[model samples]
Target chain A: MKIEHPYLMFLGDAPDELAAKTAIGIKQWRPEWCVAQLSLPGCQADLGLPEMSIAEAKAAGVKTIVLGVANRGGIIGPAWMETLLAAIDAGMDIANGLHTRLSTIPELVQAANAKGVKLFDVRHFDGKLPVGNGEKRPGKRVLAVGTDCSVGKMYTALALDAEMKKRGMKSTFRATGQTGIFIAGEGISVDAVISDFISGAVETIAPANEPDHWDVVEGQGSLFHASFAGVSMGLIHGSQPDAIIVCHEPTRTHMRGLPGYKLPDLKTTMDVNLMHARLTNPDCVVAGFAINTKSLDDAAAKKLLAEVEAEFGLPCVDPVRTGVASIVDKLQEI
Target chain B: MKIEHPYLMFLGDAPDELAAKTAIGIKQWRPEWCVAQLSLPGCQADLGLPEMSIAEAKAAGVKTIVLGVANRGGIIGPAWMETLLAAIDAGMDIANGLHTRLSTIPELVQAANAKGVKLFDVRHFDGKLPVGNGEKRPGKRVLAVGTDCSVGKMYTALALDAEMKKRGMKSTFRATGQTGIFIAGEGISVDAVISDFISGAVETIAPANEPDHWDVVEGQGSLFHASFAGVSMGLIHGSQPDAIIVCHEPTRTHMRGLPGYKLPDLKTTMDVNLMHARLTNPDCVVAGFAINTKSLDDAAAKKLLAEVEAEFGLPCVDPVRTGVASIVDKLQEI
Candidate 1:
């Protein structure tokens, strides 16, 4: 059955627009699925969408509650339990993509059971994958990598893929995260994969060889994010893309959740990503930028894009506010 | 209970001395634990030790069988299952570190259960780990990294640690692989860690805070191996070592399981490792090389080591034959 409606749940405030990546992605990719967003009064980030209460969501026939924001710990905080329990009592299933599973919480489990509501932990998918043989896969493809974690890599890739499909192109959006898995209906939650199979997981999901085909593989973690940079390198090598779109949120000053560790500049991130990606495909190139200008106004974003494009010699666009036409056109041109 | 006695089992042929890593490590690290080795006549790679058959092994009163020598696919092949079943029937417990578990094999499981023998699968340990914050951990330490999979990385670290201890310095051997887990009684099994926590897993075990301590972090996978480079990168950053010992097998032409990919030379491997390690610790340096000259004769080995030392301007030694004294001494001098 088609997911005609969904209720996104963000129980607290995000530090910035970048941290609101989940809601931003849904609003851009599948706006119709979001029937309502549950946020407390005087709290929440703007994704250019309206908000709705739990009762309003039930009245509107919302089927699932999407935990749409990633917290620092990726666990359901105590402050939000009351709201989550109410959602379960309203007979709605909860779909979470955090590291901590809702099933592990006995109170949530009991409440969900009493109401006959199911719980879906989207990040629990794991399986061994064969070693990636680093050969150049046939056809034109690109991946969207980022300067930091949750910086709009998936949204950029999906937007570019959606645009290509609209023009009747043979394009595929390959997901590597739980949110992407939920959206694509099927994909490996790559973080759950064994270390030896991390690259192989990407290679399998985003395999190329079809004539005139393109695969926009999703990137996970960040090359500079000390906690999980291993996954970043795996995806970079596994995708073996002919081109790459570097994604970033302009206003973030430091690495997410990791204090004292500063974010590398755009140039450093691109250079590092290309060096690692070329560890597999020597022909890989930085094609463009999927700039998340959510933190900046239209005027500031335009100014920043001009400077970045001039310095990096690549086309830059916001997948949400500005369409990803430049990036799509650039990849096709290559 | 201490593992005072173990029966080493290498069911089939190993490609080279480098492939007999488990036996080499055991002979050096815990010789008392190895009661005997099980190998067919006219077979078995040289570990500078004698081989024993199953009948002789039983006559010697062996208690537990240690799965030595990693195979091509990490699965118990058809030819080996019969021998493994026979060992179980003879009232000996089994301990396996292969990717495929003995519990999954119905025939072996039933036989072990009937004979009241226990099975230990060492690669199944996994859990969620916090991300590495990339903070400056206290004290000085070094990690042993390699250019390819199973190229004597773990053995190098253990040898270095042992030598350091013999010199009366404070040092610890931290294992990151299944073989090391078996030897150390406990470890994170770095390959089994979730992608998001790869670095964190390394940090948790190899943490350093003492003013005069060192952590000899065992390496896994390789920087150039496309299959699991992510894990390598994560371990590099998570451990945040002051120095790194690069391990390599002169005979490994391609990656262990991934063919068509030529091995990166020492300089290239060191350059790549330093580039990634510098992402976390800019002060990190490539200390030396733990060369695996298992295929060469004694005279040929000395010549190759001298040439390698002259070229890279770093101390070079085989952990098993040369005993890692040069690497340990060089680290102390640093």
Candidate 2:
């Protein structure tokens, strides 16, 4: 059966305050989206109110349900599995977006498969706004800000924005993953303000704690965020963007040089998460970018871009070229 | 400081009754090995007792210790981790073998790394065995059997045995793992017969219940029996065998298609077990075989082997090739 008015959910371990804030953030993204904020219980007996949410979803004709399957503060086991099964049996489509744990996947998959339920792996959706017509112009611009974030990612995002804008395309700056949260009071206010200011040419400040939150933001833009967590998978799964940009660490510079660096561990995680996502939602575009130039040396920048393109099979541009002219050029072509 | 004559200990979740028998099995292979078997609680309490024993080694020393890592009929968790750390700190070397729960690898790796101790990821080591050495006329034919009570793993052991015998090489099989307990016997008469038969081939029959009962029967192989409840990692660390072979049901056949079949969930319990094996012994081989080959065909099999080789940069062969003459040709060259 096709699900109608489906609500995407993310299950994970966050502080109680963070959980409440995340719930608020999710609500802001989709005002009409039915969200159940369940506080992870320390024991089976403590699983008091969440049980009712499962029952309510079934009774209220909710077809789709997303769950963050991580227990950050406590241990979840067979009893938790039983609770999840009840939700599925009650006809809630189950999806998982997790980073810290991997064992949970098999059990969740086995449960979903057993009940003939759809399991969406929300790691393949890339959050990119489509470019319409043959015109290239400056699109909307967004500046994502975070403290102690990866500088390479910021540059790549800006470059993409400039390229799109040069074609007369409009784009927005998305503050996603840790950076998004950092700007939104997860850290010092001074640091956040400074970051926001440095992120020049930002049109709209779309701050997102998780990648899936990008779905709600309107406009064509780039996501510039530090992603040590499973942010890449979440953004890819939730957004289904035209392209993706990743900032590579300096020590591990060459994309394909290291054994596990080129694709990174994220690729394996994506393979599993996206396979599930594709099974549920088939239309998705996959692309990637890597930031390499530390200085404005044009040759070095181009080399880095070329390497990124070769490794991820995506179009990459030098970060130095990210300016109004580049944006206009991109907009004219788009 | 580098440890001399270091003890490599393995702790697992074998039933209390089968601990001694498992210890015996281990001792047989390393006659100069010292063997010690201890109950899960006793081991955890740091009761200053040797876990298992083998004959005295003139060169280094023969000391084998096995302890139960999990409680009787209980799921593994943080307590298990604490217990394991204490044991390792108390001078135990490795924990579970390759078949261990995937939830424990990070902790095990951390503990080993912290103490400068060695870890064995059993599954990978056992799975990747070199079928034929590069010498002409092939190397010695060896059949390793893990006899515990888990029927799920019988097919894997049998397949390895069959493959080894098929190569026109003389091979002998012994009971290891859960099946070893049956040979040691608690209530079953089949244990005696199985024990007697295996005694001829195996140097030590690891009785699950008695760790110190190293009974030396004339002409009968040594019996080293001990519990391996969560000690799959231990097997991977210590025994850098030619290859590793595992038996599982059709449900597990999907593992064959994984990036690294032996280390599919390396971050998890299963992968941790396999990783320990791979890391402890870099030159060892790792492979896996399921009893249900119905899901496997020529194309699927070749793809599976290719996946293993690509992930680990190692050679993998099908157990079905035990009868193929080309196997002999490859072995002869090895």
Candidate 3:
């Protein structure tokens, strides 16, 4: 739950659409954890955070330079090597949440070790998780689902957990992917797991052992997103949540990482998720909706929220702009 | 397409339910490819084929020993090593479709090489597949989807392809898993693939490039099976199928590998699958139903088929016993 020290996030060679992941993630949850944003030319204008140069970030006592945006294909380019080595020599640790491991790269590994700073590759996990056997969990499972990847599944779960703990409820935000793993410090990178063992990994992480506690689990990939659908299904089954919070990014026309694939509607999306969830636990229900209207203006977002609420008869709110109180209320009742 | 030589199958200490996979798979399609069945003491009676000792298989000119059943968790037991090594020493090539590859085991590798016999790890592959883009395939795609794993997705696709070719249609049976890979000689093991690239693998296998033809694509997992629903979704989205053959095992009470998970009914399964498929291809439709009525007696099987046809208003048949002509006819019309 602690950042330990201030961190500067470097969005080196990250495209605008992809680079927003780090800026958006920090804005919604831990704005304080990030002191500034460092981006190159084209992406600098739309980073959605206070802009700062490397010198300014260092002057602000930033301990780690987080590689925030998970680039497509998770590649760390040879062009970025000079900047990375310079940061390490400047006595700052680096945290990466890419599929490629920083530990495996000899040049980066030696540079970080020389400065006595850590290189956290959040996506890298050595432990193998077995397939989930639907073991009896000790607590209520509240899993946050979404219409597509990076639509706020983890943020919704985290936001819901933060809100619940504010009322003195014991809640656990179970991380299922790399960024969530970075935020939580420990988790099975569910996508990194072998196909057969995904559910098992989720079950192990949120084993329902904590009595009266709510395990707010993160979701990955959408039921609609063709790329990571297997990971999504595994998370749903393994977590075995009694209540589901459907997160939707309203402005997303297509699934992330999968262009030309149109997103499913809110109702279809909710029904599809619940239809599968009910397969393992028949009593499973869609408790509420966590909408991400970040792309819409405040007034237009409110209008769209009202429309969705009227259509689905569920409490809907952008968890980032407004707290997830409405969804939390529905969840507690469930 | 060429067997080249005959092969014996080894199902070592595999549980009765799982061992049936090998017995049933070979019995339906490539009975001629298999010379004899080789099992340890316990699984012998339930093999559903003519039994053979190692000596009998070799004398009968069996060219390879195929590991038929894919074990749960894909774990190859240490206890089975003696039997496998003996088979290698006896000059029998070993073919495995399990995720636990024989190529990774030193003992098996050394023994096979010494005997000059090839070891076929069907699930093992070096090439990485990308995410399936809903490309304009040249030929029509008819995917065989199912309500649960082992409900005969692969069997139905194979059966439909056979029937179509018999009727003088250009049909290609594209295998998505290991057993089908062994039978077909080449195909991607979709479940073994990374979660992100499942659809891409399917696209590569069943690309719509064959004009005036049918790609009878094999489906994996189930939309209702809590454990592998993601794989199911990926297959559906990646294939961008023009039509769907919904397969079901009439007498099964639960999904394979997921204990106590009651199978989703045919109509609901069809609706849920189509709902996701339409996210990419709006013209996608459930063409027919492939009922695996193997466990039922003749009268009961016929009665169940009649009931399914009446209920769903689709062509229903046990693709193996009765052939997939009814389903194939429905596909051609679509």
Candidate 4:
């Protein structure tokens, strides 16, 4: 779904900073599109943007109100209804990444219909998608795969895209998840799609582009995670990337939510990902590594990165501290 | 959904035998369950069963009227409503495998509610499924993986289950597709599930069982297929099969629905499937091979099977022509 900007970031009584993760991510990645912040009474989080009402946001030419907070139970509680309706009346579209569908709220639906504003629920994908044909499409693509879930894959992708752009290369960030979608302003939440269309949805998200252009596609679940490897496989085959940056978090003892399942080693993870990826793009290669060294001291993180680089003969970096310039440089060979 | 036995197969105005493919498959695999057949005036297909009205079928102890025909469009047409409603009134539940949802028919819904009957739409999966946790569970599960889509995966699964039972082994057939669901009387159409829950739904389909018991799980799609590798990946990881029987059609030149993409070699397909399967079941192995030889002459089919058997040092048989006896024999090691 394409959510138009500039957006009014809605932090509707969010309980804490983590609740406003999506909004914070949007502001961090696409600062130009986040025109203002709209908060309800008792809201505990902020994006540090100019506080604005519906009228003020409209005056600033806000095109959409982004429901970017994760409230308890992910519901649109009664407390947030009045402000949401006011924004709808102000002629701005609504983009939500919540369990509660915006279309489920009758008053918002009615007002949005009257105002001709669109409602985008990024978590639900009902649009028709073709089965993936496995055809090679024109474009150079790179995907950020991971050793496990929540291991900085999205941050690596965005960093790669930014670095590529800074190098004056023709590149675009292709988002495949919620926060990524808000940052990119468009994408398919591949995991929410019907299983049969996972690859097809990814194909649409990163369709054919100019041969010289790079679609730095954001990846999803780990190929080693039992709960979601299917989505990961489809993403790999669908994007058909020429290069993949392996993302990992070394501090985790096991896979997320799976106590006994240890995260696969980076070598196995990369091999498995590349094996499936070769189905669509035979020449797919591992460009580099993105280690989420958040828990590590700078010296320790650098030492680990250097060891991994030495072992694999590829560039390795923490997308946060070291930057992905070397990784983007490696992409030059493609 | 577990559909009751003693089924009245409904071939409502089937234009051709292909339209009644589900009915034909159920009759072939679960002959005892096919008590009778019901047809409309314009029906052109026959299952060679006793013709019975809804009342007659109910009197003969039929518990479910299976809407086993596909109409021009996958819709509950006006023509079939009267018969469907009558069946509900006759105290038989409706189990539909069509794209049309049986719950959408207002009259049928109203009648079924009053009669305390249920509607089973096999194609739609709205039930809640937990995310797969990648834990190894009890039971010996053998999945029938394939070289491409539309190979003999389901047939081989059924054959293995049947032969295992004949040998006094505790075995059950786990269905993963529409026809397999109808034959087994229960299963999740894995492809129809949400992408994130593919593996989770599969774990439900083939849950932990007796240590010596075998769940001969029906596989779907191919790990090598572009359109549906996601489903295949999930099925492999979720079933955690101790042994996998690779099913392949000997005469196919390319992957299904993709003209340019050639099917992976049998060795590659088996290795890939086993590699993924080993995530949960570390000792997973390729138990046998099931070759679909319907397109080949008897001599050629036999020769091809022998060649594959020698090449891989595995039991190889055509489920239709030579039977899957050898494959079941190999499962004894597991």
Chain B: TM-scores of all predictions: 0.74, 0.31, 0.80, 0.98
Query: Residue B209 error for model 1, in Å?
Result: 4.0
CA shift of B160, model 4, Å = 1.2
Candidate 2: stretches off by over 4 Å: A1-151, A157-212, A215-243, A246-284, A287-316, A323-334, B1-36, B39-64, B72-334
> Per-residue lDDT of A111-144 in model 3, one digit per residue for the tens?
8887787787766555666766765556888888
In Å, residue A267's CA in model 3 sits off its true spot by: 2.4
Task: List, residue by residue over A1-334, the lDDT tens digit for candidate 1.
Answer: 1122465555355556666676666666777777777765445567665577777788888888877677777767766787788888888888776768888999999999889887777787544578777777776668888889988898888888899999899988887887786576457878887777888888888876686898889888888888878988899989987888899987787889887777788898898888877877788899888888888888998898888889988888888888889878788777
Give per-residue lDDT, candidate 4, residue B242: 92
For each candidate in the order shown, give its overall lDDT on alpha carbons.
0.79, 0.34, 0.77, 0.92
Q: Rank the candidates by DockQ, best first.
A: 4, 1, 3, 2
Task: Give the poorly placed runs of model 1, Cα more than 4 Å off.
Answer: A1-24, A33-120, A297-299, B1-24, B35-95, B100-120, B297-300, B320-323
lDDT of 3 by residue, B212-290 (tens): 7888889988877767776777788888888998899877776776566778888888888887777667889888898
Model 1 C-alpha lDDT per residue in residues B241-305, reported as the tens digit of each score: 88899998998778887777888899988987887788778888888998899899999998988
TM-score of 2: 0.29
Question: Model 4 residue B173 lDDT?
Answer: 97
Cα lDDT tens digits, model 4, B1-334, are 8999989999999999999988999999999999999999989999999999988999999999998888997878888998998998999999999988988878888999999999998988989898987888898899999999889888899989889988999999999988998899999999999999999998999998999999989999999998899999999999999999999987898899999889899899888888889888899999999999999998999899999999999999998899988888789976
- For each of the candidates, the C-alpha root-mean-square deviation to the true structure, in angstroms, is 6.0, 20.9, 5.4, 1.8
A243 in model 1: Cα distance from truth in Å? Answer: 0.9
Ranking by lDDT: 4, 1, 3, 2
Give the poorly placed runs of model 3, Cα more than 4 Å off.
Answer: A1-95, A106-120, A124-126, A257-259, B1-24, B31-65, B69-94, B106-119, B124-126, B257-259
| Backbone clash total, candidate 4 | 0
